[model samples]
Target chain A: MSRHRLTVVISQAAGKHPVKRALEEALVAALIMESGLDVSVIPSLYDLSPDHTGRLFLESVHGDMVVLSWLFPRAAFWLLDRDGIKGHLGETLLKPAADDDDDDGEPEAPRGIGAVDVPERHIYCIDLRDAATHDPFIDEVRRIAAECRTRREEKDRAASKPMMVELGTSLTANGTNGTNGVIGEHAATMPTFTAEQLLQAPGRRWYPVIDYSRCTNCMECIDFCLFGVYGVDGLERIAVENQDNCKRGCPACSRVCPEQAIMFPDYKTPAIAGAPVGAIGSLKIDLTRLFGGEAKDAVAQAVAERDRELVADGRDAVGMSVGIAKRQADKPQGPKDDLDNLMDALDSMDL
Target chain B: MGSVSEPLTFMMGKYPAVLPAELRYARNHMWCRAADGRARFGFSSYAVRLMQDVYFLDWQVNVGDVLEVKQSIGHIETSKAQSDLFAPIAGKLAVINEELLKDPSAINVDNHGTGWLFDMEHAEGGDAGTMSVQEYYQFLEANWENTQRILKGQI
Candidate 1:
C-alpha cells in the first residue's frame, strides 16, 4: 500500500475561517474515501506571513506529499509574487516587483534560502475556496497523492534516507491526519514577527487604507473583500482590519468601490500610454470593456484592429486575420425550450 | 443582428488581452463565431490570461450530441482553478479540437485561433441568444470589478 503524507498550512485561525476548516476536513474525508491509501493530513497555522510559513515548510519533512493550501487566491498570489520566496524554490514564478509599493527601499533576501530541498521535494499551491464542490481540485489532489506515492516507492527501492523527520513535540491541538499523521508547529524558540513589523518589511506594502472623508458606508468593500482586509470597527464603520492579509499587486477592492474610497499606498497603478493611428480607438474599446460603456462595435473588431497593429509592429497578433468569421448574435431570440433541453441533458449527464 | 462584421478594436483596462468583435460571448467567458449555422467556440483571450497555466481540458459531450445554451460541455482545469465550459448557443455537437488533447497549453497560447474548444451545428430558429461582443464588453466592464474580487477571495 502507498502511504501519502499531506501537509496543509492554514494562514488564519480556524475559529475565524470556518470555510477553510470545512474544506480541510472535506479533503481529509475525500482522500481517505477516494484513494483508500494510508493518508495523513498535517495542519499548521501561519497567519499568511512569509517568516512563519516559509520557516515551517523548510524546517521539517512531514510526508510524501506537501500541499501549501490557502483559502484565498491572494494568499497564493503573495506566496508566489510579493513574498520573494520563489527564489528558494529554484524557480522565478513571479514577474518583476515594480508593481508593488514596498516600504523598505532596500531589496530583501529570499526566505528559506539554504533550507529548501527543491529537487528532493515538491510544493504546489491549492486554493481551497472551492475544495468542496470543484471535482477538478479533488482530482488534482488525488493525482498528486498518487504521484507522491509512486515517487516514495521509487525512492525506497533506491536506498534513500527517510524523508520525514519524526515529530518530537505533541501537535494534537492542530488537527488529525488519519489519527497518526504528525502535525508540525512553528519552533517555539523562533522569534515571531507582529503584523505591524510585517507591514513595514520590504515587499509587503499591498494592504488597503480607507479615506474617511470620501468614504460612503455602502458596505460593498466590506462584503466584497474575503481576506478580512475590511472590517467594521467599534463605531460600526468599515476599517482596515487585517492589513497583513492583503495580497500584493492586487488593487481590486479599490477598483470595485463605487465611491473610490479604498486606496493602496504601496501599489503604483500602471499608466496607460498613448497609441498611434488605429491603436487609440482600440484602447478606447478596451477601456469600455474594463470600465463599462456602449461601444460602436463588438470586441472582435477592436481585437482585429489591435491584431493588425501588432502584426504591423512585428509582434504576434491575437486573432485569425485570414478567415471570414461569422458575426455575433445581437439579441436574445428566446431560450425557454433550449433551457429545458439543457436541463434534461444535464440530468442525463449526471453533472 | 447588428453589424457583426464591423471592423473595430478595443482594450480592457491596461491588460493587453483583446476581445474579438466577431464572436458572440457567454457570461462564462467563452466566445463563439458562427458560420453556415455551425458555431465554433473558444475561451476569450482575457479569460485565457486569467487562467494562466492550463494543464487539462476535458470535454463531456461527443459529436452528434445536442446541447442547449448554458449547458456545460466541458471542463477546464487550470493551475489555479477549475471552470466549466458552457455552450454559447443551443446546437448539435459537431467536432472537438483533437490537437488540444495532446497539448493543453495551446488553450492559453493560441486561445483565439487553434485553441478553440469545439464546434456545433446551431439548431435552426433556436438561437442561443448569446451576447454580442459590444454587449459582452459592456457586461465585462460592469462585472470586471466584482469578478476580480471574487477571484481574489474577497467576496
Candidate 2:
C-alpha cells in the first residue's frame, strides 16, 4: 500500500524549449519512478480552462499536491484557484529569497479571488526554474509525503480520543455504536490517488497571465501587442484570446501596460515575472529610470521592441504611431546613487 | 586522473570532498568503503557540504534486513532540504550507526569517519553502477556549475 496520497503535477511550458522540456520530463521520471508519487504531466497552467482535461484532473485530486510549474509561484496559485483547484499555498524551501521589504520575507501568497465554497486542500507550487535538476524536487516531495503520512496517522489517533463513559444508569448498547469501550469513530479515509499514474500532457506552454487585480481596462496591452495575443471579450473587458499567438520571448506589451498588470511569470525579471509592481530591488525600476524620462522611456523602449519584432515579421515598424499614449511613471527608484541625485535635482520644480 | 589513489578532498580547495580511492560513490553523493565483503557506507564530504547543517536523520530499515539498490533505507532532514536515502548497493544490513543517529551533525563534522552511516555484508561482487573515487571527483567537477545554479535557484 502507498504511504500517503501525494501528487506531483508537472505544469509544462507552452513553447518547446529543449532545456525546459528536458527538465519537465526529468522531474516526471524521477518523481513517478522513484518518489512513490502519483505524477501528472499537464499542459500550461495559464492555458487550462475550467473544462480542460488537465483542469478536470486537478479538480479530482483530494490529497496534498505539489505543483512544479514554470510560472511564478503566486501566478501559478491564482491560475489554479481560478480553475477551481482551490488550496492554500504550501511552503517550499526551494525558492529565491524575498526582497528585504517582506519583513518576515515569507513568500507572498496571492489571496483567493473569491470565497471558496469547496473545502481547500494543500498545494505546494514550486517554480520549475528554482532547481537545475530534479534532486531538490524529489527531496521536497518526499518530505511533504512523509509529513502528510504523519498527519494522517495523528488524525487517526485523535479520532479515537473519546472513550465511552460507563455509567450504571446510562445508555442502551448498540453493537455498531462504539461498542468496544470507545465513543469516537475512526476517520474514514478520503478518496485519493491510491496508485501512481502519469497524466498525459500537450507538451507545449507559454502565455501572459493578466493580473486582473492590477489591470484597469485601459486597452493599452491590446493596442501595443503586435502579435494579436490580447483581445476583448463580450464585456469589452481585456482578454487573452489568442494565447498561442504570444511570442515566446516577447514581453513588449507587459512594458507597454500602464497598470504593470501583465505577468509573463517565466520571465527572469521580477516585476514582469509576477512580483508586485514597485517591489524593492526590482530591475524594472532601474530600467524605467535608466533614461530619466520615467514614463516616456519605458514606453519608447517597448514600442521600439515591438517595431523590431514587426520588422522581423517583415512588416513596417509601427513605432509610437500605434499604441501611442502617455504611460504612468514607474514608482520611485531604490536607494540613490550620484547619477540619481543629479537626475532628481534637475527634475525638481523651482518654487 | 592525477592519482586514482589520491583523496579528492586534497584538491577540493572549495568543491569539498574527501573521496579516498578505496571508496566507491553513488550519483546521489553517498560513499561506500568496502573491504573483505564487509562494507561500510556514509555520506561523502560533498553530500554533507551540500546539506550544510544537519538537523535530523532516521532509518526505515531495521538492522539485519536486506536492501536492494535504489530502495529507500532512511531519510535525513536539514534546514536546506530533506533528502531520502537510497541504497547504492544491494546488501544485507548489518551494523547501524547508533552514535551518529543520536547526533546527526556528526555527518557535517566527520562524515568519512565517525559519521559512517551503516554497515552491510556484500552482495557477492560489487555495485556495478557506482563510480570510483577518481571518477566521482570528475563527476563533481563537471556538475559544479549546474549545482551552483541549483543553489541559486536560477534557470
Candidate 3:
C-alpha cells in the first residue's frame, strides 16, 4: 500500500524535558490511532531561529493537518490567508464563527478537516490543552476521518477535479496582513504581553517594560514568539501589544532574543519540583490480600461444581456414555458407505 | 572476568553508570544490534524510562514483511500516551518477540534483554547507521537542553 502523509506541528517553548515531549507525542499518536488511520510519527520541529521561523511556517503549510497545542493568538492570525491548503486548527477552534456553514450535517468539523476555497480536502488542527481535557476531541477526530473517507469515495465515483491542499501554523501573535486581521480584530481582544514585557520583573499587566537600552529592533523575538507580544510603537520603540493572553510560564520571546534585553524572573521556574517519577513504573498489586491463601482450593471447588451442573443438564453430550456408544457403532459404516458411493459414481462415469 | 566481590565494592561506592548510549539509539529512543548479520532490536532503557509503564505493544509489520527506514513498525501504549516506534533501518522482519505481546511490562523491566521487539534480516545492505554509545549520550544532552528551552519558552 502507498503511504499517506500526515504532519503534526506542536508549538511549544524550548526547554521541555524528554518525558514531556514523549507524553505529547504519545497523546497525538493515540488520537491518530483512535481515528483508525495509519500514521508515521515525525520527529518534532524544535525551536526555530527567528530568521527560520517564517521559512518553517511555509514548509509546515504542506501538512494534511496542523496542530497548535499552545495559545499563540498572534501566530494564528498571521497564517489564515496562505492558499493551496485545507482548513486551519486555531481559526476553527478559537473562532468557530469564522466558518461559513453552521449546519453541514456534520459535528463541528475537527480542528483540521474543513473546506478551504482551494479544494475539498480537509485539514484538522487541535488545541493540545483542549484535547487533553475533552473526550470529544477523540470523537471529533474519528468523525473527521469518516467525513474525509466519504468525501474521497464520492469524489472518486464522480471523477471530480482534484484540489491542491496544504496545512500550516501561524506563529505571529498579531494577525498576518491579509484576509484575517492579526490577533483577530473582530473578536474581543484580550490583553497579552511580549516576552520582553513579561521579563521586566513580573508586576502589573499593562505598560510592559521595553528596555530601550538593549533594544535591537530586529523583530526576531517577535517573529519567534506565537503570541503577538512585541510590536513597534509610534516612536519606533518595541512595545508589548497584548499582555493578558500570555500563558504564565511560556517565555518563547526571551529565548529568541539575541540582544538579551528581555528578562523575566519567575518565567523559567519548574511548575513542579524534582525530576518527575513515571506513573507506570510505580505500579503495585497485592494479589495475596485480594484472594486469600485458600484461593486454589476455592477455585477447584468451583470448577467441580460447574462440571457437576453441566453433566446434570446433559450439556456435556460429548462426554455421555450413550452418545459415545452411538458414535462408535456408526463411525466405521459411515466412511465405508461414502467410499462405496464414490466408487459407484466413478464406474458409472466410465472413468 | 571481574571478581564476584566487585559487585560489593561497586555497590558500596555507587551503581554502575547506565549512560544513554548512541550505538543502539533510535530517533524515538530504541536500540539495535547486529546478531549473525541479522538486526536484533528493542526499546532503549531511556525510552522505557521515558514511557514509564507500557500496557500494550502493537506492531504494524508482520513477519516476512519488508520495512523501510523511518517506517512506523508499531506503537506502545503507556498510561499517559500511545507512542509510535519507528524502524531505524530498512529490512525484512524475521521474527517478533511473542513475550512482549503477552507481557509488555518486560520492556520496562529488562528493555535491553527479554523485551526485544523483533529480529530483522538486512535487505541487500541495509545499515542502521546508529551512533556509538558516546554519540547517543551527546544527542540526548543536546535534545534534553533543547526540550528544556522549549518548555521554558526560551526557544
Candidate 4:
C-alpha cells in the first residue's frame, strides 16, 4: 500500500468559533481518511504574516499532499506569490465561510464560485457555505486522492523520479521604477486576484528566460521565484533552475530582470502534442467525418432529416446527436463527457 | 497641572494616529459614512493596497438585518488567504455591493467608491462616540508607526 501523508494548516486568527472550526477540520480529515490516506492536522497559533506563513508553507510542501484552511488575510497571497509557492502544490484548496451571506444580509445560502489555476495545480476556493453539505467537497477529494494514489504507486514501483522539464530561462528583476518593486505588487497593493477571481482564470502572463552571460551571481531571482525555479549548479553558476514548474505564461522574471535578458515566447500555436491521446491513437476519431466535404453534405442531410423527424414527433434534436454518437462510438461513452466529469470531480475536491 | 509654557514629558516621542480626512475608517480597515440616515461603507484604499489579488468576497448579511459593531460582516479571499471584514458601527444593513460577490477585484480598482461593501442605517446618536476624522487620522498614524516598529523587531 502506498503511504500518502496529508497535512492541514488553519489560520491562527480564525476567531474563537471552536465548534465550527473543529467541524471543518473533521470533515477534511474524514474525506482524506476515506481515501485511505494517512492524515495529520497541525494547529498553530502563528499569525499569518508573510514571513511566518511562508516558513509554514515550506515545511508543509514535503508532505505527499497538504490542505490549508482558516481565514487567511489577503496579504498572505502576496507573500505566497513572491515565494512562488503556488507552483509547488498539486492543489491549493480553499473553503469560503458559510455565513458570508449573513455578512451581506443575503438570505440565500452561499455557493462555491471561485477557482484559480496554477501551472500543473488547481486551486479550489470553495464557499464554506457549502461545508454543511460535505458531498460536494468530499466527493471531489476522493477522486483526486484515487488518481494521486495511482500515480504515486506507479512512480514508486518504477523507482523513477518524475521527469523535470527545463523551460530554459530565469526571471531577472528590472530596476525598481519607484513603482511596486515586486513581481505581484498589484496583488499585495490592490488585492486584485483573490477567491472571487478564482472562479475565473487568474491572468498568467510572461514566461521568464535567463541570459547566463550577463547574469551576475546576485541571488535575487532565486529568492523571488519561490517556485524553486532558480538554483546554483555544480560549478556554482546561477543556472536555469526548476523549469518544469514554470507556468505557461509567467513573465514575472522578466519584470524583475535587471539585465533585461529574460524573454517570453508566445504560446498560441495550439499544438496537438500537448493534448491527450486515446489507446488506439490516430487523433481518437476521424476529423474528416465531422469536417470533410463529403461528410459535411451527409451531416447536413442527416440534420435536416433529424429536424423533420423531431418536428413530426413534436420533440427536438437535443438527444439525437448524443444517441447517434453513442451508437457510432460502439462503447457509447464520450471521452469529452468523461473528461468534463473528471475536471468537475477534481474541482470539487477539498484537497 | 504643569506650569504654563512648560513642556510636559508625556510620551511626546510617540507617533500620533493620522488618517485621511475624507476617508472613513473602521477598526478592521473598512470605511463608512452617514448620508441622511443610511450609511455607505467599503474597504479602504489602504486596505485594498495591503491585500493584493482579491479573488472572492463572501458577504452573508442582507438588507434589514441589524449588525453589531465590530462583528465579522464578511471576508475577502486573495490569492493567498482570506481576510474578514468587521462592522464599523452597530446599524441595520440596507444594501450590499452585489457586484463584488462576483468580481472582488472591483475593490482593488476603486476601493473607496465602487468597492463599497454595504450600507446601513445608523442607530440615532450612534455617531456620538465615533472618532472624528482628525482623531481617526491620528489613530492610523500611530497604528502604522507601531506596525513598522513591529516589523523592524522593535516591538
Chain A TM-score compared with the true chain A, each model in order: 0.34, 0.56, 0.31, 0.30
Instruction: List candidate 3 stretches off by more than 4 Å.
Output: A1-351, B1-17, B20-23, B124-127, B149-155
Query: Where does the lowest 10-residue lDDT sum fall in candidate 1 chain B?
Result: B146-155
The TM-score that candidate 3 achieves is 0.29
Per-residue lDDT of A26-133 in model 1, one digit per residue for the tens? Answer: 666666665323333333222334454343343343343334344222233233323323312211132222223333222223221122223355554554543344
- Weakest 10 consecutive residues, lDDT, candidate 4 chain A? A268-277
Scanning candidate 3 chain B in windows of ten residues, the lowest lDDT window is B4-13
Cα TM-score per model: 0.33, 0.44, 0.29, 0.30
N/CA/C clash count, model 2: 5
| Interface RMSD list for the candidates | 16.0, 21.8, 28.4, 25.7
lDDT of 4 at A226: 40
Quote the positional error of residue A104 for candidate 1 in Å. Answer: 23
lDDT of 1 by residue, B1-155 (tens): 45667633435457666776777776667778778777787888767766667877778889899987666566666664555566666778899899997788888878889898888887863236667888777776766654554443310
Ten-residue stretch with the least lDDT total in model 3 chain A: A268-277
| Residue-by-residue lDDT tens digits, candidate 3, B97-131 | 99899889888788778988888887755345665
By the TM-score metric, which is better: model 2 or model 3?
2
**lDDT on C-alpha atoms for all candidate structures:** 0.50, 0.66, 0.44, 0.43
Q: Return the TM-score for candidate 2, rounded to 2 decimals.
A: 0.44
lDDT of 2 at B135: 76
